[model samples]
Target: MRSWLLKSLYVLAALRYPRIRPDLRYFVRDNYFARLNQLRFWRADFLTKTPYKVVEFYGEFDQEIRYAMPFAYWHFLNGTLKQTVASKNTRPFYFFSPDHVEKYEKRVWEAGYGNYSIPNMTHAPTYDFSKWARVPFKSHYQNDVFVYDKPLLVIANKYNIEWDKPPINFLDIPALDRLISGLKSRYQIVYNRPLGGQIVHDNSEIMDLGEHAWLRTTHPEVLLMNDLFDQHAATVQNFNHLQLLVYANCNHFISMHGGTAALASCFGGTNILLSHPGGGFEHEFNEYNNLFPNLSGATILHAKSREEVFTLVEGRF
Candidate 1:
């Protein structure tokens, strides 16, 4: 009955935001519903704060970065966060908190990736992290280990499965060539495209772009993330750790959409996110504009096409 009522009310909200797909109407409404639950616990936060105030997530990396991390960090700031639970190799992200429990849920990854993990994070009005505490990943990881003589520029690329289609919003080799040729002289480029096993697997499969060898041969000056992970095998925990450390130093990024762009935004820089799809949750709620930037007050330039990418690169980067 409650689901039926929200579904009926969602029709009105959908008309106002018609870009959202029909199937996601309830998901968005449920987020707003869960958000309303916050008021019921507002008074409890100060007096009832306890070690039980934990946040667990095994969702899409993008949503995890946008919603789950900040939600947990907010609990940390409020002194209520006790133990964070998530998949493996994520301690680096939650190191600032009191405790983190790494428990990989490969089976549940299929259903994860929304504001459903915790109730407070269900708010629909905002994704702003300004009032919230920003996880000090950059300050904690930024060190002299990965310093470069030139200003570092990270091009975090992704070539994999996406709901929108093959050209879901990743840069092909030719476009990469254009960016590298244009920016390599001014910046020390670190090209990142994590292999499948390196990052926790999800529904999305990592399709081979076959660009690793091309980057080494075509632009030997450019750094590859896989090689860096190999070179600093003992120094960091995993590929995610290396990315945080390296990305912490740079202030400019050209990345594919989804988690790649979200991670880049967390470190505070100008992130050119290639997002062309029209009907994903990103477009549905239209919240990423605020959510991504507030992650660290980063400047985000959304380029809907490959041509616009270079245009923003020329003007912003």
Candidate 2:
């Protein structure tokens, strides 16, 4: 009944606000139905028979890292009761699509929750991280097994929707070059470009979804970083596991404000998060600072100027 009402509201919104019709449609199709399914599951007591409590996290990339992963971690630390998480990326949610479920399922398995995880549930779980906002996240997972021999520095550059916004967290080619040049000598720099032009829902046509052709034209240095550093570059396609492994093992991480950075916070390494001042630094800073807490080596900084970013990166090294 509520779902039907929300669906009606979505139709009304589409009719009333044609300019944002696509965005509204997405909310109705993905967000609403996913939550409705979750409500139905809870009311039906579907997981009552299971030994471990199940948390169905059906959100996009940012939500998974920022909310879902932490929500699960908090529960793991606070209680002895075993718990599993169903981290779905199916329709209505665009971050982790069905095509990429295998990698995420492998991630869940590698994290020692193989028995507990249901990474690809078709019905999908609802997004309900607000309940765990006040709850603290501790670094209970260790990366000793995954650490590299040399000091590792991980960099995650985002050039997607942020490109349209004011230059806050987005780093241009020259800036990236300077940073990479300075750090390459001391630490093994691993670059991660997790998203690409392909849309998660449909893999056929290339869209201006992520770091489109702009990165190649403007920031060729990002592509050249691997050759310069004698290391293989990591992207969404082949390096999901290695990306997480490097994050877990890295000594320091430099990342743009997004899902990738949020995931890095889970590893409890020194993280320098660059945020755009005009892009809501105060909100991002407060949310991350609170979510990860003091113990977590996560620092959110305003990237108003390139000099500040350079200084922060240099200081970390």
Most TM-score-accurate candidate: 1
Q: lDDT tens string, model 1, 133-212?
A: 66777777889988998999999988887873564778889999999999999999999999977878677777989999
Provide the TM-score for each candidate, comma-separated.
Answer: 0.90, 0.53
Model 2 Cα lDDT, one tens digit per residue, 145-260 = 44454687777765555434433466666777688778766776666654432222111121232332544564453332323222433322334434544565665777776565
**Which ranges in model 2 have alpha carbons more than 4 Å from their true place?**
1-52, 74-149, 163-168, 197-238, 281-285, 294-302
* Alpha carbon deviation, residue 208, candidate 1 (Å): 1.1
- Cα lDDT, model 2, residue 122: 16
What is the number of backbone collisions in each predicted candidate, taken in the order shown?
Answer: 0, 2
> Where is model 1 more than 4 Å wrong at Cα?
1-24, 105-110, 113-132
Local accuracy by lDDT, each model: 0.77, 0.47
Q: Native-vs-model 1 lDDT?
A: 0.77
Candidate 1 minimal-lDDT segment of 10 residues: 122-131
